[model samples]
Target: MTEIESATTPAAAHRRPASLRDWLAPPIPGSALWGWLGPLFVTLFAGFLRFDRLGVPKAVVFDETYYAKDAWALLKFGWEHKTVKDADSLLIRDGSDAKIWEDGASFVAHPPGGKWMIAIGEAIFGATPFGWRFTAALAGTLSVLILCRVARRMTGSTLLGCAAGLLLAVDGLAFVTSRTALLDVFVMFWVLAGFACLLIDRDRSRRALAEKVEDGVGGSLGPFVMHWWRVAAGVCLGLACAVKWSGIFFIAAFGIMVVLWDAGARRAARVRNPYAGAIGLDALPSFVSLVVVGLLTYLATWAGWIFKPGGWGRGEVAGNPLLRPLEAMPDLWRHHKDILDFHNGLTTAHTYQSWPWDWPILRRPVAFFYTEPRDDCAAARCSREILGIGTPAFWWGATIALIVLVGVWLVRRDWRAGAILLGFMAGWLPWFVPAFGDRTMFLFYATPMLPFMALAVALALGLLIGPARQATVHLARHAPSANRRLLGSAVAGAYLLMVLVNFAYFYPVLAAKIIPYEDWDARIWFNSWI
Candidate 1:
C-alpha cells in the first residue's frame, strides 16, 4: 500500500503519536459564534442582577461604612479623611453635608487600588450607596465575561465555558461582594484577570515552541520568545496586590505556575536538559515580568499618598530597624509601618468573623444589611437581609469536584485540572495562616476563589457530558457513543437547572427583599447561617 493508504488504515489511525508536542496540541475547535455570544449573554444577565435595586438599603452596609467614606475622601482629597461621628446616618439622612468629614487623615489597613476604583464611581454617582458600589458591580460583571472566555480556552467547549460564567453570575457571594463597596471584589476581579492572562500566555508559548520546531530553524531546544502576555499577567497580579495584600499569594503561586509551564513546553519540544534550559532562559525573565513589575505597579498605586502631604503616616517614623532604610522617604516608611502594624495588631472580635476552614463549607456568612419590618409588609413580621453567602449547591458541589480534579491531575496529567487547582489554592491557602492569628476574617475573603470553584464545577460537568464523538473515515468511534453523549448532556443540563433554581430561592435574602419571617427562616439551612 502507498503511504497515504497506509495512513488512512484503521490500525494506523488508532496509533498515538510518539512526540510530546503532538500530544499537547491545541484543543479541537468549536462553534465561533457561541464562543463570544454565550459569554456576552451571561455577562448581561449578571449585570442586570447586580445593578437592579442597587441603591436600595440606602444606608451603608457592613464595612461599606469604612470603604465608602474612604472612597469619597479619596475622590475629594488625595487621601482618606476621618469622618465625623454618626457619619453613616449623616450620609444616609443628609446627602449634602460636607462638614461631616474631619480634616485630618485616617489610617487605612489595605492598599489604595480598590478605594481608587470606588472613587471613580463616587465621582460619577455622588457618593451614595449606589455610587460607591457602582464600580464593584461593573467589575463583577466584567469578571463573568473574563471567566467565560478563559473557560472556553481551557475546556475547548463554548457551552461549558458559558456554563462556568453562568454559575459565577448567579453565585450569592459573587453578587454580594459586587454590590458592596468593599475591596474583596476588586481583588477577585484582578486575580482572575491575571490568571486569564497566564492562560493566554500558556497557549501562545506552546504554539510558538511547536512552530519553531516544525520550521526546522532549531532542534530540540526551542528559541527564547518574548511573551508580552506574561507581562500583562504580571501587571494584573500587581494591581490585585495593590487592591489587597492577600493578592500577594496569587502572585507567588502564578509566578511558579508560569515558569513550570515554560519547562513543560520545552520538554514537549524534546529539548535536552529542558529543566536547566527553562531555569537559565525563562526563570529570570519570568521573575522580572511578574515580581519586579508587580512591585513597581504596587508602588505606583501609592502615588496619591506619596505626593500629598499630611496623609496618614506621612511623617513621624518610629525608627524601626527594618524600616529605617526607608527613612530617606519618611512618609513612605511610616505609611508602610502603619499599615503593617494595623493589620498585624488587629484582634477585635467580630460576631460574624469566621475561620478560614469554614469558608469553603458556607459557614458563618457576614450579614451586610438587615432589617425587621412591622407595618411596611403584609405579613405579621418580615425580614430583609443581604447575606454574603454563596450558592450552597454550587459551592458544596465544587468542593467535591475540586477534590476529584486533584486525582485527574495526578492520573490523567491534565493541565486544565492543575490550573484550576492552582487558581483555587492561590486564593485560599494564604488565609489559613491568618486564621490562626487574632486578625478578624470573614467568609467573603473567599471571593477570589469563587471563580475557580465555578471553573471546577464547569470542568466536572464537561467530563460528565463527554466528548462530541464525531466519526472519522478510518476509525470506529465506540467511546462517547451517541446515546452516552445524550444521557451525559441531559444530566449536566439538569444539574445546571438545579443551580438556577437554588439561586432563585436565595435571591430574596441576597438582594435584601423583604419576605415573611417564616419564608426567610426557610432559606436559612443551619443555625450558623442564622
Candidate 2:
C-alpha cells in the first residue's frame, strides 16, 4: 500500500476514518453541471416568490417614501433634490413628474450606493412603484443564489446548500425587504457576497498549501499565497459599506476572521509557529485586500456626488472647526463628516422602532402597508397588509440553533460553525451598541442577519440527519443498527416541514394579499404585531 493509504487504513477498518481533508472537502463528487442545477432551481423559485405581484399596493410604504423619492432625484439631478409638497400623491396617483421637485440638493442621511441601484431600475421602468423596487427584488433574488453556493462550499452538500437557499427564499423579512425600495436588502446582498468570496479564498488557499506539502517544497512555515478571492471579498464589502455605515462592523469582523482562518489552516498543515506565520505572511496582504481595497471601492460609489457640484453638505466646511484642518481636501470629505453628524444626531422617536435584544424574539415588526378593502371585497370586512415579520418557526428555531452552534464551535473547534457565528455577530451585535442610545432602530434592521440565521438552522439539520450510509455495509445487518440515524433524520425532516407550514400560514400578511379580517387577525399571534 502507499504510505498515505497505509496510515489511514487501520482507522478505516474500525470506523469511518476522520481527517481534515474529509472534513473540509466537498461531500459529493460528480459533474459540476449537476451541482449548479440544484441551486439554480432554488433561485428560480425564490425569484417567483419575490416578483409575484411586486407592484401591488402601488404606493410608498414605510421608508420607501424617503428612498424612492431620493432615488428619482438622484437619477435626474446627479444628487438628491428636495421634492415638492404632496410628492407621493403626484408620483403614485397622478403619475406626473412636472414640477414635482424643487431645484436644490436634499440632505440625505445615507450614502448613495443603494439609491444608485434604485436609479437603474427607475431609469428602465420610469418613476413608478415597480420601477423603484425592481433592483431590490433583483438583489434579493441574487442573495438566494449566493447563499446556496456558500452553504454548499461550507458543508460540501448540495442538498444542504439548497435547503439554506430555500429557507431564505421563504423568509418573510427577506421577502418583504426585497419587494420594497429599501437600503437594508442591498446591505444584505453585498454582505452575503463578501462572505461567499471569503469561503472561496479559504478553499483555494488550503488546496495550494496541500500541493506544496506533497512536493518537497514544504517548510516549517506554510508558503505565502496570492488570494484573488480575498480581493473580491474586499470589493463586495466596500459596496456593502457604501450602502450603509453599519456595514463597517462586517468589514472589521471579517478582516479578523480571514486572518484567523489562515492561522488555523497553517496549524492543520502541521507548520511550526502557525500563528506567527499567519501574521507575518498573510496579515499584511489581507489588510491591503480587505481594508485598503475596500476603502477605495467605497469612495468610488460616490462618483455622482464627488465629481458634481451642489451635493448636500458639499463646500459647506468653511467655518466648521473639526473640518478646518482638511481645507486642502476635496468637498467629498466634508460631506462624509456631515453624513456622520446627521446619523449621530438622530434622536427622533418612532412608533415601530424596537431594540436589538427584541429582534430575535420577533418583537415590534414594522407594518409596511395596511388598508381596509371593504368596497372591493365580497366579505363584510377585509384587510390587505405587508408586515415585515420573520417566519416564526424558522426564526425561533434558528435562535436555539445559534446557541448550540456556539457550543459546537467551542467544544469541537468546527470552522464551519465558527464562521456562521462570526457572520451573525457582525450583522447583529453592533446594533445593540447604538440601541442603548436614542437611535431609531427597527426590527427590519435585522434583515442582513436572516441569511446567517437560516444557515445555522440548516447546518443543525444536517448534523441531525447524520452522515450517509456506507456503500459496503450489508442492508440486513445494518438496518437495526442504523435506527439512531433514521430517528434523527425523521426529526429534522419534521422540523423543516413545520417551518414550511409556518411560512405558508403567514404568506397572506407577508405578501399583502387581500384576505378576510378574521383571517388576518388569526395570523397576528401577538397584540404587539397589530
Candidate 1's TM-score reads 0.92
**Mind giving the per-residue lDDT tens digits that candidate 2 earns over 391-498?**
998899999989989998897677778889999999999987777877888998899898899889878877776555444443223323367667876887788788
Every model's TM-score: 0.92, 0.91
Candidate 1 lDDT trough over 10 residues, lowest sum: 1-10
Residue-level lDDT of model 1, residues 305-374, one tens digit each, is 6665567867433345455334426667777888888888777999898988898898899888889977
Clashing residue pairs in candidate 1, if any? none
lDDT of 1: 0.83
Best by TM-score: 1
| Candidate RMSDs in order | 5.0, 4.9
